[model samples]
Target: MSPKKATEAPLTRYRQTFSGKGSFGEYLDVSRRFGKDKEWGVRINTELLNGNTAINSNDMEAQGIFANIDHRDKKSNTNLLVGYRHLNIEGGARWFSLKAAAIGKEITKVPSAPEASKNYGFDGLAKESEGYIIALNHEQKMNADWKWFLNAGMNSNKLQRNIIGASSNFVIINDKGDVSNNLMSTQTVTKNYYAQLGINGNIKTGAVNHDVTLALDKAWHSIEGAKNMYNNGSMGSVSGNIYSGLQGNNVWYPSIETGLSSKDQYWGISLADTVKYKKAQLLLGVHKHNASVDSYNKITGRVTQTVGSDALCPTYGFVYQPDEHTSLYASHSENFDKGTIVASKYANAGEVLNPAKTKQNEIGFKYANAGFLTSLGIFNIKQANNIDVYKGSDMYLQQDGEQEYQGIELSVNGKLADKWNFMGGLMYLDATQNKTQNGTNDGKTVNGAAKWNAVAVLEYNPDEKFSIVGRAMYTGKADIYNEQLQTPSYMTYDLGVNYKTAFNKTPVTLTAMCYNLTDKNYWTAYGNNLILSSPRTLMLSATFDI
Candidate 1:
């Protein structure tokens, strides 16, 4: 039982990078335990305007920090781990732009026109968010075949936005050339706090593994906003029948508003079992979730609004490995998009709704050999009770509709030669809104689902000291709106080089990365009459290890 000979020494590595835009930055670190068999590390990341295509006046910044610690003792059946994370976001498009077809009329993008000498107040809104989270977890082995774990965490967020400029201008011009404008402005602030507790365990017997988890969570949110002015000097009035050649006006005034906040409590339990025998494995699971939101409406001056729902989700899957080099699998699962709990509480009674639900099925196969590995998968998803904005309403509502998305994905990764390695994947999607109320969207396509997408990378490592890499990506045409407005597809490329050597007996590494090498114009997401994408940029970094 004497201690074994030491085979490896502790190692530490550090890296930092600065990009051309001064917004894109990165840091990395690696560490290993020296004596106590404990390891801890952290990573810091920041990206600015990575691919946002908003006009020059618009800007964005993001920062993230992640840290983890792990400790283990061979004598005890217990272990402890802790994690912390922080994320911050600021800036974005403030003012919308108009499309070519909607030039003459005040459409989605046009704001109130500025006067010659008066301040237009046309500045776009600025958003700021701060979040802090911490998690503590513990694991215990109850027996040779049973293990259990418990985790608890808390998170708090402060979100505020300064909205300048008038409200959106929704103007329509009839054949007779009459014009009208609707203008308004407001500022909003929201704060949220969340706490969660969960416990899970697994038991192994023969060829079957049983797993179970139960969790409870609570969230509190506060929202405050002032509607300073209404359109066309209208105050304390609500617009009605404002479309179809009818003119309606509303006037809203700024007032010190304090409404009763909203709170939500949720609890869920899940059980899963996996049976593995021979080359075949089967997994089955079911989950039950219950949630409730309660709030007091200032207008009503009473705590009388409450919304609650319960749902059960089931999943099943099977995998067969016919040989060491090939395998096939299929799975079916249900996913839920929990509706905004706070929003439902403040809205009018009978307007609140439960979360949307999605059913998904996927089948895939994989093949691997000494020099090649590949996988192909086909998946379909159907969603119901989607949340969409009503055409003329300022409030959000849920629709009893269904949408379908089917897609195929293919991927490969392997070494082509002693010094060359490659990895790539391709995805194709056919997304459509299958059914909708009023039949207005019966044949419409879903936005943001590109018909085709692909990425490939090649890396050459001739020796340990020097290496090079190149990457390319292609995104095919995608519908910009549910009505099938299409945006053109695009392609982009990237390249990188790295050198590692010993300086004064200490290892040093230098890297240079160039992204969007071709500087192509590509849109990531478009809506609300705005388009965003990123241009090419270069980044360089150096690392030291001991």
Candidate 2:
């Protein structure tokens, strides 16, 4: 290929991936390229998935496949895309269990709790789900200084879960949760549609440069699930010990009750602008969001209650670049989110919370050169829990709180020498509840929040024939629930190697990696059950260019 011709590519391409895992699996794709100024083509891609080959899982043995097709066209500065995707995931779910010992004692999450205190946990669950999506995207270069785009997609999904297991003091829900033994086998399905449109461009006036963006978004979602609840647990005592829990007589089967359903929709818009003059740059943006939710009663055939909300979020930032190698910046941002359906554990399950709002302020300094970059920043965040209010005729109530977090972060990435490169970062955060109901949780550390964390990685490459990489990750001690349940910190490492060669005169690569290099065992989750980090494991793979 001529040097100049090499710079001008084609408008179509094909690619495939073939792998052997005892049995074989593959992925294939054929599409028109997006390289030239004007192009149009159809592309089809598919993959066969087996969860066990990708990573360790506590809940599922998933085996499913997905495929998508796309037709893309580009005319000058304008582009359009039409696509469709289908997914089917069905698998046998795994059961989970936890012990009281995992939550307290010297080797446990809490200091005051005694070891081997009546252990209770739950198990036995499975799930099957399928989904499909249709989408369209368009972009137009309205003018020299302005461009616009719109993206829209509709999705439909159906899911079913099986609760099958012994009714003990505590049976498992799935890997992530535990429910009252009063829980039952359940099924749920949801549908959603979303669309977004935006316009962005740049313009300059005198010594100042400006870039701006304006956008609008809309979404609709609905969910309905069938539920079952088990009743009839006879609390009994044995050996002078009272073993009264959800342990059942196994005779009273759960009755399928009225399943729950909810519908919600969201509308949002954003406007932003960036301005620069000499060594100074400034950014300003504002976003408006509105949402509404309705709960439906199948038996009543009526939409019971509604939660509606609207919010405005704003952000501003400024940067000073005294030179090419150094920068100082400060920023403030606001976040607004619509509350999700309440979890079964919450006292207010089934109710839609008011929206949640959060704000953050940050300042940072960075130094950058040809081969290395480093930065340090500090931030403070304040959050208001969803504004909860009692909606008439609803099964759930109101719960609200406030929280704050202050943290510092430092990061660095660069080439240490001629052939060695390294990257790392460190963070320390202090998070606490500022206010809550009845002041019961005031001043307590938030759950799942870590105090300090750090990570680092180093890579060596001498001539590309072979390269080696080493990585280190560390997590500081964390609180599961206030000071009641705490988990210790842990550090783990990974090593990787890659070699390049030729197979049948085609470029081929071999890669191998060892995860959890030191096989460090530490608590990953301090929920009802204890979950541990993955132990040391090796993975190897080969890739070929055909």
Candidate 3:
């Protein structure tokens, strides 16, 4: 008889997200080999997110699960996969505002409003959602050096809100300190669906190779809501007049009797080729995209037709190696963003708009020696036909514009000693606009583009049973739109330690980790004065493998 074949067991792993708020969650992932070929496998993963903000009494929770099966030939000539995923999110708030003006009512200053707090109430909001998705993919080798692949997928999502109780009662006071006790409750729901299909292939010939891909997608969405107030004792009465624009008794009345629906179709195709000879390689590609949108009125429920412009893009790159330990590369690419249906619905009587475009270029070098790898790169990017939100107005403006961004980045990773390893990167950017609405070139910078950014990591393993790791990141000052505000960048650090051992001959591991050690105050994004940043937090986890 033949010798007995070896069997491979499944593998499992776990991870957790650390938050400053007392909110914590974890994920479990497992993968297993299938059949004697060892080229087929299956994987499953589950994750959860939960946390509470100081503004709300109830905590928020989100959960997601996914599973996939993949199979491939031993020669990697054919491959197949199937996948499914589900996600659920639920949370509650003291109050939820649907419109931006409602948000302006709670905060004294318009621009100073904390974006996060406004999502629910002065300090309360609640929301929940569930999403489901399925996918199938296949790849086959037609020749010794040619392959074809195709994928199709679909997704469905539903969202709902729950309002049950209030922990505190508060009054909205004007500049004159006039107070009004108005308590209200409301709920809303929304649903969305999406589907997509795509195919790609590649071929090789002598010293040249060619690759191409195409894809198409479609999506649909809808929303509905109702509210009830405590003081009015009526289901659809207006509570009080906050903004001087509408006539109603209570705030729970049906205000927006409107519904919106849209149908979108998109097609994209790209062709890329590479030529290799000696110590150098050259790559070039061209891509084209076309899309159209049709919107249906919620009240009339009639489809309105709109057409989008076709976009053409081109890209090129070169790579050269002068020695075994050093290499250099450079690339240039163009990108475009299509105008949306909203612009067609709300544009001036005869206004017409075009898609925005961006051109980017970069050059870089890489060196590896003595178990250390280092890289340096420089990039320049410019954008035209840009879109901007009009200052002090709720309208958008499109202009023949130009903005430039120049940046340099450097990174290194290596082992310094028998027990230590480190990796770090630093980047500096100089960005400004060459043209705006003012006719003249203003040196104003774009928001969210920081001038300096850096990340550092260190790891130490003294023995096979114990290890420690630390990481830190820093972001420099960035510009903010509106009021010409400036947001100060901040630094965050994380550290973790792990211990492993055998229990009853079963492998076990324990880890303790801390994030945002300094609890530095910073804004997550620009334009929203949301003092929202990950706070300092600690997490402890245990795992077992059998």
| lDDT per residue as tens, model 1, 1-546 | 111111235445566666644544444444344344542323232222332222232344555554444444552322222233333333332232223344344333222222111111223334455565555555666565455565555555544333222334222222232334344433344555555455556666787666655555555555543333223344322221111122324423333333444555666767677767779888888878877766555445455567777789899999999999999999999965555443321223223355677899999999999989999999999986354342343324455577788999999999999999999999998877766778777766765567799999999999988999999999886654354345567788999999998879988899898887866654453332324344466777878786
Candidate 1 steric clashes: 9
Per-candidate TM-scores read 0.74, 0.77, 0.74
How far residue 400's Cα lies from its native spot in candidate 2, in Å, is 3.5
Off by over 4 Å in 3: 1-9, 13-26, 48-58, 74-124, 161-260, 341-353, 384-403, 527-531
* Best-fitting candidate, scored by TM-score: 2
lDDT of candidates 1 onward, in order: 0.56, 0.60, 0.56
Comparing 2 and 3 by lDDT, which wins? 2
Q: Write down the TM-score for model 2.
A: 0.77
Best-matching candidate per lDDT:
2
lDDT of 2 at 442: 83
After superposition of all CA atoms, the RMSD between model 2 and the true structure is 7.2
Candidate 1, lDDT over the whole model: 0.56
Question: Model 3 misses residue 515 by how many Å?
Answer: 1.0
Better model by TM-score, 1 or 2?
A: 2
